[model samples]
Target: MSGLMQKEYERVKLHATVMNTLFRKEPSDSESPRLARGQRKTRESFDARSVLKHFKDYEFGSLTIPNIHLSQRFSTGQDLYYQCVAMAALPKS
Candidate 1:
């Protein structure tokens, strides 16, 4: 692999990490103290909007991921499985 491909692979991994973080993790109640009600509401609203935006631009099928080479690496099938896991963990408004 060349430097550019390695960079692209890293980028994709980072993108996957961020997407997983944004959509996968639940807002844990056992974490730090609560936010103000207004703040909580604001976060919920923002998350809802983000989710909607994602859905609007959604295309869950074959993809040409630049660097990651796993044969079945498109954001579909198993990839969909992970994305759904993330989206399911997203907050509702």
Candidate 2:
């Protein structure tokens, strides 16, 4: 994939991973202003460093893509696997 496409993919993956982690953590103090007001608060926002730390040293499975046309690359599933692995290997930054 092109660098721009790769970057965009990474951004989306990171966001999803971070959001999942955030919601999975323990609930925040309900005594806080926002919560005290009875407003619902699901998860708090965190910095990139925190998200990177959560995903550091993670690894994903590898894949082998068959030699084929772009349009049919993922028809056999291998190409999709390869793309997922490629995106997972991207930098956490």
Candidate 3:
């Protein structure tokens, strides 16, 4: 009777292991080529000049801020200086 119970317990354990393996979901290792191609197309179509031009037009036309009065260059330089300082302060990996 004890031998039979031990065999039944082993069988049930093996069955549970097999069922878990069969139902487990595996993660995809790589992205589909179609998705990669679509991403590349989107990256290719991004134009920095067009974006800058749009912002420039909005700033001047809507805000009525003349270029001569704008300190954009100075502000950009200041931002870059702070960014550089912050990056330099980060510990090297």
lDDT, candidate 3, residue 22? 24
lDDT of 2 by residue, 1-93 (tens): 453232333333221121444335355546545445545456666577986888798886775644332221222355442233222233333
- Alpha-carbon runs more than 4 Å astray in model 1: 1-19, 28-74, 82-93
Best by TM-score: 2
Find the candidate with the highest lDDT and give its number: 2
Q: TM per model?
A: 0.16, 0.22, 0.16
Arrange candidates by TM-score, descending: 2, 3, 1
> lDDT of each prediction vs. the true structure?
0.42, 0.42, 0.32
lDDT of 1 by residue, 7-80 (tens): 33434443343333323335585685766744522222235676777789687688544334332232445554
lDDT string for model 3 (1-93, tens) is 433212323433211111323223336525534345324223222346877877775754434322221122112354442122111133334
On lDDT, the stronger of 2 and 3 is: 2
Order of quality (lDDT): 2, 1, 3
Whole-model lDDT, candidate 2?
0.42
